[model samples]
Target: MFYLAFFYPVYLGIFPNTFLNNHIIVIGIYGPLALFTTIIVFGVGFPILRSAYISLRDHRLTVDVLISLSAIVTYGYSITSLAFLGRQFLFFDVATTIIVIAIVSNQIRAKYKRRAVRELTGRLRNAETTVYRLTDEGETETIAAEECEEGDLFLVRPGEHIPLDGTIVDGQGTVNEALITGEARPQRKRPGDDVIGGSVAIDGAFEIQVGENATSTLDQLRDLVWNLQADQTNAERLTNRVISAYTVFVCGLAVVTFAAWLALGETGDSAFLTALTVLIIACPVSLSLVTPLAIGRGLSTAADRGIPILDQTVLERITDADTIVFDKTGTLTTGEMHVADVETSEAADEVLQRAAAVESRSSHPIAAAIRAHVTEPTQSTDFERHRYGVTATIDRETTAVGSPALLDELEWDCPPSIEESILHIRERGDLPTVVGWNGEATGVIALSDTPRKRWEDVVESLSAENRRIVMITGDDPRVAQQFEDHPAIDEVFADISPEGKEEIIQDLKKKGTVAMVGDGTNDAPALTAADLGVAMVSGSDFTVTVADALVTTDDLLPFVDLFEIARKTRRRLVENLTLAFLTPIIGLPLAAIGAVTPIVAAILMSAGTILVLANSYRPIMSQDSA
Candidate 1:
C-alpha cells in the first residue's frame, strides 16, 4: 500500500496524457484502487486503532490515538471527496502513507528492544540441560535436567557443567562457578558443600543430590532479567505524560483549526487538508521511541560486560548514590581463606607438608588453604577428622593440624612460642591453625580472607569524587580491622548483625542516596533497605532476588562500568527526548498555516524518529569502541 501510494504520483507525472491517466479510466479503475488501498492500510493498522480505543476507554490519551485520528480523518475526507468532487480531489494516498509510517516506526523501535533482550537472556540462559542422573540402582544414566526431581542424585564429571542446584553427597571437585557467582576463582566443593548449577567442574568429580526444589540458577537469572526489563521506569512514566498531553493538545488544535478556517469562509476541502496536516505533523513517534531504545542499548551493553541490570529504575538511582556501602565478605574480599603466613619451630617445609597431608583429606576452607600452601604432602594414614582439626599419622609419626581446641582435644602440648605466634596471628585478624607432632605444637599457619583483586582500585574509583565509601561486616572488629585503615574508606562498621546492617543502611539514607553491594544471605536486609542494591552472583538466592542489579562475573570493576553506563544512558534519554519534541514544536505551526502538507508532515516525523534512533545508539557504539 505504501509503495502504491508513493508511486502513483510518479506514474501520473511520467504519463500525464496516457490512456491510463484518462479521467474516465482513472475514475472507473484507479479511484476504486485508491479506496481499496486505504482499506488495506486500515486493516494493517487495526492493532494501532485497537490500542487507541483501549486507551480512550480508560480516559487516557496516547500517541497511538493521535496517529489513529489522523488516518481516520484523512480516509474519511478522501472518500467524501472521491464521491462528490471526483478523482483529482481524492487524498487516499495521504491516509495510507501516515499509517504506514507509524507501523514502520513502531517495528523499528521494537526490533532494537527485542534484540537487546534476546542477547541478554541468551548470555544468562546458557546452562546445560542434559545431565548424568543416578538411578535407583545407583548407576548413572543420562537424563534431562528438568526431569530430575528433589533428592535425585547426579554425577558430574571432571569438566561437565552441573545441571541443577544441589549439595555434594560424595566425591569432590574444583568447580568454576564464574557463570553463576561472577567469581573467576574455582571453588573447592566436597561432601556437604552446596554447588550451583551451570558451574563447570574444573577438576575431579562429584555426586550431587538435588535440592528440595530443583532449579538452575541460570534459569532464575534469565527470568529475573526479563521481569526487570519489562517494568516501566520513572523516565518512561515522564515520557508517557509528555506524549499524552501533547496528543490532547494536538487533537484540540486540529479541531479548532478546522473550525476557524471554515468560519473564515474557506472551502471545506481546504479546511480539512490543513486539519489533517496538523494531526499528522504532531505525531509523537520519536518521543515514544526515545527512552526505550536508549535503555535497551544500555542494558544490552551492561549485560555483555557481565553486569545485568535487574531494575530499570536503577539507571536513575545508581548515579544518585552519594554513599556507597560495601559488605566486606564476598563483596570486597574473595570470601576464600588463603595462607597468608606460616610459622614453625622446626623446618617449615616438614611442618607444612605434615599439616597439608592431613588437611588435604578435609573440605574445610582453612584446610584447603594449608594444602594450597604446600607443594607436596606426604602420605598420611588413619586420617580422622575432628570439629577443630584433623589428626593423622605422617611418615610413621602422629601429626595434628588444627586450632588450640584441636591441640587440647588431642592432649598435645602447645609450646610457648607457638602460643605466642597464635596470639600474634589473631591480633592481625588471621585464623591461627596449629600443627603439632611429637605431642607438642610445632607451627601456627596464619590464614586470612584474601581481598579480591582490584578491590582497592574499586574503592579508589568510587571515592574519587569525594563520595563516602563505607564498609559493613558481620565479622568481629579484629577480622574487619584490615579494611578500616584503607585511605579511601570513610567509615567501617564491624560486628554488625544483619539487622544492624539494615539500620546502618537507613541511617546512611538519612544523609544521602546509598548503594549497597553484598553477596551473602546476611546482606539481604541491608540490600533491600538501600536505594540501590548490587549483589554478586555468589550470593544466596534470597540476596540475589532482592538486589536491584547483579554482577554476573566475579569482579568489582563492573561497578565502575555500570555507573558509567547509567549516566550515559540518562544523557542519551535527554538528548533523544529533545529530538523527539523538536518535530512537533517546529512543524505544528507551519502545518496549521498552509506551509506544510500531509506528505511533508510524514517526512518530518520520520526524520525526527531517525535522529532519535541515531542518538540513542551513540552510547552503546561508543562503549563498544572503547
Candidate 2:
C-alpha cells in the first residue's frame, strides 16, 4: 500500500497523464493526484489520526498525535492551496511519504518476529515423542512417554531416547548424554546404572525402571522457551515515557515556529506553512518503536536457538547480580548416583551380598544401587525399617544396612578401620551406607552424584566477573563438600529443607542481587524468593514456571550471555533515543527561521526514523554468539 502511494507520482511525472479533473471540495485540476491523495490520507492517516484522538481523549502524549497533527496540517493546507493559491504550494507528497516509511519498516519488523514464533513452536512439537512400555513378562505396549509413572518399567532399543529418569534394571548400553550434559563422550550403562530421561541409548537394549512421574525433561524445556518468548520487559514502558516528553516538546516547538514566523513579517498562510514544516520535522514516529523492535529482535534471536527467556525483568535485574546461588542436586551435579568406592573388612563380594539381601526389599534409590552391585537369595525374619536404613535377620545373624545413625541405634559398634573409611567417604562428598553382621561392622558403600563436565569452567567464568557462587542443598554438608571445595565457590549451605532454602535466599538478598539456580520441585519456593530465578528445563514443572531464566540447553553458561545481552539492549535503547532526539533539534530551529521547507522537514524526519528502525533490526545476540 505504501509502495503504490510512494511511487505513483514518479509514474505520473514520466507518463504525463491528461486525465486531470476538478473535485467538489476544492477548485483545481486533479488526475492521478486525486487517487494518490486518497490512499495516503486514509491508508496511513487513519491509524495516525485514530491514535492521536485516543491520546487526546485519554489525556496522554504519544508519537501518533505528533504524526497525525503534522499530516492533518499539511493535508488541509494543501486543499486550501488548491482552492485559492493556484495549487503551487501543495504538500500532498510530503504527507504521504510520512506514512510510507512507517508502514515499510513496521511490516519488515513483524515478519521477522513471526518467523521466530514458528521455530519455537516447532521445537515444542518435536520434544514429545512416542515410547515403548513394558506391560508384563516378554510383552510391551506403545505409550506416550508422559504417561509412565514411578516404578513403571520401560524399554529402550539402541538409538532410541531413554524415556524417563530411571535405573537400568536389565540389559546393557552406552548412553550419549551430550544434549543433556554437554559431554560428548558416551558413558557405558549396565544393570543398576541410572539413565536420564533425555539421553539416547547408543547401543544395546535395556529395561529402565522409572523413578518419578512421566513428564519428560524435553517437555519442561519446550514450555520454558515458549513462556519467555511471549514476555516483554520494562523497555516498552521507557519508550512510552520518552515519547510523551518528545510529543509535548514537538508540539510546543511547532507553535513557537508559527508565532515567530508571523512576527518576522510573514503572511498568515506563510507562517502556518512554517509551522507545518516544524510539525513534520519534529514528529517522533521512530521514538515510539525503538524499544519493542530492539527487544523483540533480541527475544527472537534467543528463541531461534532454543533458549527461551520467560521473564520481563531478568535481563535488567541481572546486570547488578553479585551473588549466584545453585541448588546441589540436578543443577550443579547430575541427580544420578553412582557407587564411587567400596570398603569391606571381609571379602568385598560377601559384604555386598549381605547388604543387598536386606536392601532388596526396599525401593529406596540407595537400596537400588546396593542391589545392583550384589544380589543374594536368603530368608529374612524379624525385619524392621528405620528412617535412614533397615535391620533384619539373614542366615540367623542380625544384619544392618543403613546410615551410621542406624548403626548407633542398634548398639552396633563399627570397627576402628570401618569408622575411618566412613569418615573418609563423608569428606569426599559421597553418601555412605554402613553394613554389619552379628552387631559387627563389615563394610561401607560410598555413592556420589557427579558434577557436569562444564560446571568448573562455568563457575570460574562467573567468578571472574566478581560473582559470588553459593550452593544450597538438602544433601548433608559432607555430601556437598566436593562442590564447595572448588576455588570458584564462595560458600555452601547444606542439609537445608525447602523452607530453609527460601530463608537463605532472603538473607542473601540483603547483601545484593541474588540469582537462585535449581532443578527440582523442592526448589520452587526458593526460585520465587530470589531476585532472579534460573532453572534448568530438565527440572520439575513447578521450578520451571517460577524461574526467570530457564536454561534450555544443558550448560549453565547462558546466564552470562543473558547478562551481556541485557547490557547491549540497554545500549540499543540509548542509541535509538539519541538518534530520535537529534532530528528535531537540528530541524526545528531552521523551520522557525523560515529557512527550511516542509518537504525538507519530511525528508529529515523520515531519514531519522529509518535509521532507528534499521539499527533496531540488528541481531543483538551476534555480538557474542549468545
Q: Estimate each model's TM-score.
A: 0.72, 0.69
Cα deviation of 291, candidate 1, in Å: 1.0
- The local distance difference test score of each candidate is 0.76, 0.71
Residue ranges of candidate 2 with Cα displaced over 4 Å: 1-31, 44-48, 83-85, 109-119, 129-232, 301-306, 339-424, 433-445, 520-522, 538-543, 619-626
lDDT value, residue 308 of candidate 2: 57
Error of 1 at 107 (Å): 2.5
Predicted candidate 2 versus true structure: per-residue lDDT over 1-626, tens digit per residue: 54344334533464232332224223333435555776777775676778779999999887777777777777778777765665444677777777666666557656655554554556556546456787875445778777777888877754456757889887675676654575757799988988877666654567889886545656645544544436556777777887788778777887887787788888888888888888888877777667766666665555444455566466567888899999887678765666777898788877777777776445334666776775453555445555446777888998998876667778888899998998998887687788898888899988877786588887898899999999897666788878878999999997675557889999999999898888623365577679988876652222234466667666676756777677887788788878877888888888778788888888899889888887776668665232
| RMSD (Å) per prediction | 8.1, 10.1
lDDT of 1 by residue, 463-528 (tens): 996789999976656677778988999999975655578899999999999999986333655776
Candidate 1's TM-score? 0.72
Error of 2 at 341 (Å): 6.6
Q: Show the lowest summed lDDT stretch of 10 residues, model 2.
A: 16-25
Residue pair clashes in candidate 1: 182-553, 182-554, 183-554
